[model samples]
Target: MDFHALQQRLRRFANERDWQPYQTPKNLAMAMTVEAAELLEIFQWLTPEQSLNLSDDQRRHLGEELSDVLLYLVQIADHGGVDLDAAVERKLAMNAIKHPPKKS
Candidate 1:
């Protein structure tokens, strides 16, 4: 996805609604944690097998919570002037080196 465009869109969304004042990094972080908690709650009682086999209703709810966390993450990164693409690439490179493939 075009994250830059998405960030601008999110910014405009909040701006038009006058939600910018409430979209501070702190608040966004807190809100993301709450959404993450909600996400965790969805699986709190389910066994591994059950969690893997969600019903349609559970799947929809899972997607909503995931999006909530992602949206806040986008906003937070935008506000922090972080380039998500570059950051992800850098982290992935580091991870690849740290966890190199083992020989068969």
Candidate 2:
């Protein structure tokens, strides 16, 4: 997916609705958290195996919540002038250094 294009689309969506005022970084972060909670709610009562093997309907709902969380995250990154792809790469590198592989 073209992430930049997706971010632009989301920006236009909010612009058309005059929602920019409420899409501040703080608000977007909160919205993302709420969406994450909703996503977690779906698996609240499910076993690990059940979570791994969700029904089609459950998967659909999970996708919806996940989308919400991602879009909000994208918005937050955009507003914060963060390059999401680069940040992810940097974080992965840091994690690799922090947790190197064990020798066989």
Candidate 3:
């Protein structure tokens, strides 16, 4: 996916709705957390197997909640002038160093 494009689209969406004022990084972060919690709610009482085998409706709802979380995250990163892709790459490298693979 073209994340930069998606970010621009999200910006336009908020701007069109006059929601930019409410889209502060702090608010976006909190919103993302809330959306993530909503997504997690889908699996709250499900067994591991049940979680893995969600019904069609459950999957649809999960996708909607996941999308909300992602959109909020993208907004937060944009507001902070953060490059999400680069950040992920840097974090992955850092994690690899911090937790190297064990020798077989």
TM-score per prediction, in order, is 0.94, 0.95, 0.94
lDDT digits (tens) for residues 1-104 of candidate 2: 67789889999999999999998899989999999999999999999999999999999999999998999999999988899999999999999999989985
lDDT order, best first, reads 1, 2, 3
The digit string of per-residue lDDT tens for model 3 on 1-104 reads: 77899999998998899998898899888889999999999999999999999999999999999889998888888899999999999999999999989985
Name the regions of candidate 3 deviating beyond 4 angstroms: none
Alpha carbon lDDT of residue 16, candidate 2? 98
Output the TM-score of candidate 2. 0.95
Model 2 worst lDDT run, 10 consecutive residues: 1-10
Q: Candidate 2: what lDDT?
A: 0.92
For 1-104, candidate 1 gives per-residue lDDT tens digits of 89999999999999999998998899999999999999999999999999999999999999999999999999999998899999999999999999988974
Question: In candidate 3, how many Å is residue 55 off?
Answer: 0.8
lDDT (C-alpha) at residue 41 in model 2? 100
Tell me the lDDT of model 2 at 46: 96
Candidate 2: give the clashing pairs.
none
Sort the candidates on TM-score, descending order: 2, 3, 1
